[model samples]
Target: MPARTYPALSYELYPPRGDDAEESLWATIRRLEDTRPDFVSVTYGAAGSNRETALTLLRRLLTETALKPLAHLTCVGSSRAELTDVVERLIGGGVRGILALRGDAPDGVDPSEGDLQHAEDLVRLIRHIEAPRTAQLAAGRVSVGVAAYATRHPDSPSEEHDIDVLLAKQQAGADFAITQVFFQPADYARLLTRARRAGVTIPIIPGVMPLTSTRRVEKLGSLAGIEVDASLLARLEGARSDAERRRTGVAATVELARAALDHGAPGLHLYTFNEHAAALDVLDALGLERPPEAGTVASL
Candidate 1:
């Protein structure tokens, strides 16, 4: 295969909750547009709390931006019928790709509340979904992706079980997998090794998040069942100011990105947290935001 001319870059965004926040989000989107990510995704809330918001963002992205939007559909609190309706809405809105997920249950609720039990089930549904009469299905069908956990998912029985779930997703029709954010690239490597051994051949992209807020990132990581490197945390905590800490975080992200690509990972799926400055800075530092050559797949 020929070497890639430019690295593949993608971003994740969450819907804004209020007027001020919405304004901020647009500004971020505008800035990110300049960087020209391969695609951008909007996250669905846990238990489907923000499904409409996510849909609206996707629609606006299709019309208002140059970015390709990936809609996230989760089996959080939706029945099979309801899930189908959501997919129809996306197709109607011209979304060409979806990230199928088994999202987190709302606080104090049971995960079993949803009709679709697993990511694999959602993936299968998306693969064979019949488009509603009102909508235009992009490219005849939507491209589907599923999440991968470098470490064990919080609800998974073990690491092996989580890997099995990912393999099942591929069998169910996922075109690729984007891993949860992890501190160590080695964890992603281990996950990929196990996946390949299990006969999974689809692209698996490493999710990268630049740590700007030490406390907030740690808390979020813990909630997602991600392991933190103690020494790394200690180093961040040692920074005398927020600026210094962010600089350290950016440096670390660049290092991690290099490791993932060097290890044969397909690309970087950055968790932008609805912000773009830090992620853009990291990409610029890594010299990965340039345009790809013609005929290149732009995945590296």
Candidate 2:
């Protein structure tokens, strides 16, 4: 059969710590699963500290539910051999897709000595594994995806340079890209145009993070280099109570999702931040319910 296509809805999850965290994560997973997300992803902790936990969670999902899991793999502080071993392990575990990254350095570590600097380098390395056995070991084929910045990357001098870097990753064999979260729909529209101009044709999914609280949203925006638009900033600033801010935030996220889909974003990738209620509320507002199967969805 031809490959299926759907307006994808995906969520990102982080590795949990103890009993409470694990319970909360499962609760969130079930809540999101009810919406029939296209896929559910689990993140690797800083320096891959939770790599094993992520793997365990992937196994749990595979055995318990029908959700396809995308494990986030980072290159920081890992040698090529180390990454190859991890890839081999995931393949053996039946995981078929990865979100490759050159992760942020752990605090106080000098980044220059790391084995992988750019995500494209990781993509190139994975590509090598898919080559002939005489050249390298085959880890079976894995769908490789990379991160993109809809707004200018914090380290980039200009948006053009950022798009160029993303295009390089796509050329290096990244199958798709998931963007950093942004509040403004226009930013993603412009970024998509720039990427196409730079000749990157892969599906670019727009990342969305529901703002549960004003303070938390502001802090996240500062860290990600997203300029909370003046109008949004004003609305949040003016909200007299926490309830008002949350209401406004949900409204804003729903509006943003509508605009993104209108602009042809291939899908919506939500940063769950280990919570589901707000994200579910936003998805409901967009009229996006869960899929019958994990990754495929029926038409509205």
Candidate 3:
């Protein structure tokens, strides 16, 4: 049989908190492996709060699984030298891809304290780093990915400014971008229209985070800097119980994913929040249950 593949689908996971959580995370990883995502990304918590744990998980994924793991690097609370060390460590650890981020300021930490100011700056840094391991260089040196904002970035004054930021990162050698979770397909289209007008040609995958719970949608929206569609929000809010809310979330996410794919989104980058069932259900419903044919989608 042909190697299993996915229709350009990817999943995001976060580092676990303890040994038990690590075992659970491995189980989740194994479960998702059957989906054969193009790649899976692991997030470093805000301000590099989970750096060690994230790196540990990345190394484990590299050694223990066939999954391609992309390590997230942030410029929130580290100096340039500190970040350089982290980059070197990743290369030494056999990881080949990175997601450069200007992570949110950790609680009670001023954002200005970091030496690397913007994610674009970190993108530049990653592009220039020399890998210590020849094997890592052969693995493709360092494929740098950056974040894109489908809705305007939280700190950006306008959507145009947000596109410009992404354009700058592309110029700095970002391989591709993954957007923050967004519900409206039009939001992604508008962002892409502006980006293309500005000459950004890199793939921008739409991020999909299922609502999961009506009560948490508002907080999720706020954190992602996205606006929940009023009608969808109403449907979710009107759910009478936890199970009903979850069903509404899954159904709504499936609809949103269909709309996004219909609008020519390159692919979907799911924010799994370390949970796979809802996201897997949404993908299965969309007729993407089988692996994608070879050469149909770009490799990570």
Candidate 4:
């Protein structure tokens, strides 16, 4: 289970929307628990919508399961006081990692009006809040994670600018980074090249797109501001039945994952939109169905 030998694994999940969704999500959580991923990230809503439900889910993950939760905290439409409170709550609840983000603009709101304008600022703020509590923390500091873009972010001026932004986050105390969903291994290779050239030394985990179906890839890929991989989509479209489609999608993703590992990716971060089947399928195909025995892939 050495880091060089076996990459770390993680998942992205969102808060369950309703009672039925919660039950189904819990089932998925249980199944995922069996694999013992290094950590599971629970996404926050844009501008803190559904904040309570997200916190409740994180709380349950802390109490009822052995899984470590990485709480996503967005700075859009929130004040410093609010974010400080949220950080405090996360620490008090035994959470160690946070994915700090400058969330996308909500309806009728200007993105620039937020108290924290950049993810770097939020990273500094989290470190500032956690400084005094170092004595109580058994794992050293709160492991702050920030988003990295393999493709140019919609708000970015250039890919070089994205690399600069990532460097700034690292300077601001970010422990590591997880990339936004990318379609091809080349995209990741290019980003890593830019980052290393710019002196960004933190580990960057690839966010594996859940190519469970053609429709899911198109819709979520668009929403994430990444175009769907035409090659992967065409394969999904060529499948004659639902089962065949699932197999096709999983196979394409496995190839992408394998390519990423070959390129020296630290680990894979599979986006599970509250379903475990496809994510598990991709992991099993990668021969990572069981968690590593003695080492943590994500050591942050």
Per-candidate Cα lDDT values, in order, are: 0.84, 0.83, 0.83, 0.88
TM-scores for all predictions: 0.91, 0.90, 0.89, 0.94
lDDT of 3 at 74: 91
RMSD versus native structure for model 1:
3.1
User: Considering every candidate listed, which one attains the maximal lDDT?
Assistant: 4
Better candidate number, 1 or 3, judged by TM-score: 1
Judge candidate 1 at residue 247 and give its lDDT. 87
For model 3, the run of ten residues with the poorest summed lDDT: 130-139
Candidate 4, residues 93-120: lDDT per residue as tens digits? 8999999999886898887778999999
Model 4 / residue 253 / CA error / Å: 0.8
Model 2 shows how many backbone clashes? 3
lDDT of 1 by residue, 1-300 (tens): 876455677999999999998999999999988877888989998877988888889889999988999888889767899998898778767888899998877888777877898989998887667434324543366778899988888888998898889889999989888988888868788988999998889999999898766886798788888778777788799999978888888888888888888888877888888788899888877787467544767665
Location of the lowest summed lDDT over 10 successive residues in candidate 4: 291-300
39, model 4: CA deviation in Å?
0.3
Ranking by lDDT: 4, 1, 2, 3
Candidate 4 lands at a TM-score of 0.94
Q: Give Cα distance to truth, residue 270, candidate 1, Å.
A: 0.9
